[model samples]
Target: MLVISSSCKLCCMSKSLTAWLSIGLLVALTNNAVSQTSHPNIVLIYADDLGYGDTSCYGATAVATPHIDRIASEGIRFTDGHAPAATCTPSRYAMLTGQYAWRQQGTGIAKGDASAIIQPGRVTLASMLHDAGYKTGVVGKWHLGLGPAEGADWNGKIAPGPLEIGFDYCFLIPATGDRVPCVYVENHHVVDLDPDDPIHVSFKTKVGNEPTGAENPDLLKMHPSHGHDRTIVNGISRIGYMTGGHRARWVDEEMADRITSKAVAYIEENKDDPFFLFFSLHDIHVPRVPHPRFVGTTAMGPRGDAIAQTDWCTGEILAALDRLNLTDNTIVLFTSDNGPVVDDGYQDEAAEKLGDHQPAGPLRGGKYSSFEGGTRVPFVLRWPAKVKANQTSDALVCQIDLLHSFATLTGQTLAAEAGPDSHNLMAALLGEDSQGRDHLVQQARTLSLRQGDWKYLEPGRGPAINKNTNTEVGVAPQAQLYNLRADLGEQKNLADQHPQRVDKMKATLGRVRSESSSR
Candidate 1:
């Protein structure tokens, strides 16, 4: 009887021990899974004036974009991707803030010397990501204005630029390549700004003896077809005025390499931990200065060469990822600030040399227009281990979705005021299903909405602002509706036939904008 009792006790002890061991093993496995699937290193590569069809994956017949194509080949390519605005500054605002650019006034295309557009204490993607234990940095074009709350004193000190807006470090052009104060701004101060040769800038009035593009077409190498006539630097006239900063002036051809190197260095330095790098490339934009190596390499002249340079820059970034062995773990996203515009300012023969090349793909307008091409752009996401290879999706995602999507991926939730207009697009971006936001507010200054195959343009009085390129900007007296699935060109305005559809869309837009406003 004693032996039997002892045997029973031993059996019970062994069962208990086995159960505890199983629990410990399960916990270990759960922790490992969480660590493996948790927050990914995010690298957002944004292009300036890059069109939807410019990339081969987006259906570029004339120009091949193999490096850009690699991104799509490896991950998912979103067909219904869009920028938040039709122009650079507004789109950038939406990208960083996750709120519609038009939500805030004075968030249009900023000149080189415009007062700081981003509010000082406002939440931004960079700031949010940084707060979540990710190192943040931006390299290349920062068209978002710099300086103080009131105005900037170029001679005194530059403050409250990228650093104020959540970036741990910034290497940026003060504005666009075709705008003035034509110099690089590293962190706060303008690079090589001579104390004696104080940089003077004015968008309203011309300053000093600098020859203007309007006055001297003879001296101009790249002629202006439209509104890009101002202070000429390196034989190209920019939009604003600048008297000095000759020593700090940047050569346009070398821009791609300069920014690429900075981006790669940032990655190499921060590869041990999670990082977010906003690699904004100034390519194929105005002042189309392709390096001598890439000059005359394409049938599209400097514009084509610029495209090649942009692709080359992509290749270099990919190489950096490969070298660091972060290719599998990193989540890289590629998109543009806005759509395409050939004759934006400089006469680069982007229009004349065009031989059966469709920059805007099958979309209607380009830059600063209320048409599909103006804001809709190529969006590609690549994550090797997590996302499947060679997938395409028709996800209705926007740049504004980045904040919430990242938050969702990292097991974080955003408050209502923060990521106000953002929606999580993890499944859509990963090519799980094309289903995404039921309705999206497309912008060209006013509001438009896209729901499935149908797109509605709000009735307005202004002419589509893209006069130089002659792309339609969706300005009409009556509400406009188009079935994008059937009419990708957006030629057939079905407002008369689709009155109920238009009404329903207007209601959806009203709800979204109103709800956003309430927040």
Candidate 2:
């Protein structure tokens, strides 16, 4: 028998116990590493109407965006990134549903009282993540219409909205800043509704006796330049008419704080598990009312102040990530819904105060245009573990592709019909590959196709400039074509010079849009 003295046996046993403990520690670490690598927390921070040249990281000189720039410094910054559409409603719809917003008819810029555009039971990005055991939540501007299409019962539960579209939790502004029903919707009900003063909204006719901009301009703190001269809410004229729900009305300046608080709370609550947070921002949008702390942050007035506020909100989220010890395991994506537009509806001095600041950067057009500035937006991805730091990639990616790419990342098998327009570009997103979206469609009123270095714009019957916005509407009577590599600004049209290329591209686009899936 291999027996020894009692003291000797005890020493050997101790040595064996130490070896097993070391192995156990190693196994635990390895498992943690594997888990983090596989299931990274995703936070898609979508900014509303923020331009390509809005952030310092994207080449803006007027404002500094350290937190946004930090994301670019830590990970990949995509040069050729695009929102699905030029407008917020369509672009956001496309991003969440993984389908072209143009595919549906009701996806134009939505009103405050419009019905839910996205139907239930559809496989959406949030639904996909939810199925993969991720706690999905969305915060901020949700312009994709809520409740029923025509008559949304404001007093009742607002369904067929974000929750119906796959989001587990949602706190949203039902529409834009200029729209009516100026209330925050948390999940299904209004934040603080009163039974006595029942809310009623109407887009066509004046529902209540609320003072309107057109009727009474003297009461407004900020004046409307165009279609926003409708009903008055919070001293600002909105697009629709609202009778009641005074308590539920939101303060324009406190919007950033209110929305960001909900978003941060969501993160704090779900720190222990994997979560997908679509933090849609409302700053840099219309009625450019920044919080008191951010007032006069820049010489460019409310527009500049809003940009600073947006950066701060972004910083707050990043700080929350750090506080929760979820930095390395988190995949934070920063992008805009579309390009920027000055003087959208309100007289906000966004254009008058502008000295040398270029909101669209080197791009030609702004929002609601077929130009690069309309859809091409700032895209930054930060994943400390997977993506290398301080890298710039010229991959042609779109927000529409996020659906399939995330599905592939989480090992969730998507159905053949799901994410029909989305491509699995996880490699490109992580900075492993440069080629992304060989052919992408740019949408405004008319659709433009970008294939390789060539772009073809289909002719449409509209004015050269949107007189209201003072932006090039990108509408023309003649077919337009350009070599993007040759003309990045899209100044010289080569449609007459190269009809063959346009024809080929037009055919290619038809195939892309008509086919079942682009994968």
Candidate 3:
């Protein structure tokens, strides 16, 4: 995740720690002896609310993203990359668990104060990698939530977070950028939270005289269209209440730079050894606040500016790898958590200033929508000398495949219980045969499935168009199916025209969801 580049001192300290950690890990690597499997440094750069066409290489013309585009130009750009789910938390769950997110009930938009989603003792990708002698770390955007089990102390151990799940170290946001308990969570505890000035958060009501966007419109720099209007921070009203932890509170603009710096430092310190870094970026999401230096960087208001900031963060990370001479050995996977949306809560001139900027590229729907735009996102893999450069892959891939792909790459054998839905996409990542899965299931909080060229949306009750943003949710009664190959826009529904195909897809989606649910 991209963070503002303002905190140089903190970055320097992190860099120092990384150097020692790298040495220590290298020593461990040497002592452990090389296993039968050859492991490479893995860095997954996950962007927030990024659409398929947001980057220049992906046909975006609104803002030139030379930095983000460089990944596609340098290595492989996936044409049909997708997030397992349309939202952040579910997509992340799929990535780590290698399973379809929809199978897990209520794996939709999680609240900021929601309890830990991933159960403790569940073998995750991080834990597997750690067991295989790779140092794992997650920086930024831990929307998966944090807790110390039921009725545990906040001042004590916060179990079932990143560290508990398998990451050796973690520096993450307690929830989302728009959510409350708006503080940095480094490993177990909230960063710099003074016991004297304890933090109290609430989404339902406010405890103090915290001015809300609903009541104090004059104090808000960006107005919320729906939800995301509560306690004010840095001139913007967020989604929940935050009473204390003033010193640890992060600046929205500098978020990108800070995350990038931490990611780079982690890489630099672990350059000589195998390490896994999940660099979750917070940009182009709600409350799009670009750094002052990048305020007017694009014509698309804060959204475009935030996209530019994301690109800049990408450039910094790539530069770090090049500087450390690990570009050739390190495998970098860059993709977004979900699709894009112009107006998600905040009124940042995103929709108004969006002059022909197709955030979803050629696809329909975005973000919360069940359309292709909600899950389809730009995915690029870069590994100099190891992966063929400037290549395009039409491999049908999903974030859920990462666990198995990484496991195969590292030659780690996981029990059947772990990553049951994950399939190895190692060949696809290496730019080998382009053909991916024959049939794939997709989600949008709602359970949807896509097989080859056909897309299916299960019968459900949901808004066809989000009234606040006007993005299609791809929901309909009597089961909707579309031939995506013929109509990328999904303007034509073929449920009546192609009943046989619809039945087949329905069966496929049902079987997949049911099997996973049973597991």
The C-alpha lDDT values of all candidates are: 0.85, 0.90, 0.82
Over the stretch 74-193, how does candidate 3's per-residue lDDT look in tens digits? 899999998887888899988898767776765677787777888778878898899888999999888886774342234556667888789988888767888876677778887777
Q: Residue 98 in candidate 3 has what lDDT?
A: 77
lDDT of 3 at 362: 91
User: lDDT per residue, candidate 2, 143-169, as tens digits?
Assistant: 888887556788988887888877889
Leading candidate by TM-score: 2
Report the C-alpha lDDT of model 1 over 150-222, residue by residue, as the tens digit: 6677766677778887889899877788888778777777777777777888888889989888888778888
lDDT of candidate 3 at residue 120, scale 0 to 100: 75
TM-score for all predictions? 0.92, 0.97, 0.90
Which ranges of candidate 2 are over 4 A from the true structure?
A: 1-21
Deviation of model 3 at 172, angstroms: 0.7
Which residue pairs collide in model 2, if any? 115-148, 115-149
